[model samples]
Target: RFGDKFIRVSFSIPTPEVERFVDAFPKVMAEL
Candidate 1:
């Protein structure tokens, strides 16, 4: 899904909405 460099950059500080979206993403993905 992500390259090494992308993975490294992905962990930078996330906004509150981003954090909430990330929290729900796994559940959404699992349902699909």
Candidate 2:
């Protein structure tokens, strides 16, 4: 039988990493 067999889950970054990403986002977008 066809089945998922296992469950999947999503993960997120911590607050500090997110903040650093946000701060550098503009520079990242600019390069692209």
Candidate 2: lDDT of 28? 84
Report residue 12 deviation for candidate 1 (angstroms).
13
Score residue 11 of candidate 2 by CA lDDT: 21
Write down the TM-score for model 2. 0.57
lDDT string for model 1 (12-32, tens) is: 646775677678978988999
- Weakest 10 consecutive residues, lDDT, candidate 2? 2-11
By how many angstroms RMSD does model 1 differ from the true structure?
3.5
Top-TM-score candidate index: 2
Taking all chains together, the TM-score of candidate 1 against the true structure is 0.56
| CA deviation > 4 Å runs, candidate 2 | 1-11
Error of 1 at 9 (Å): 14
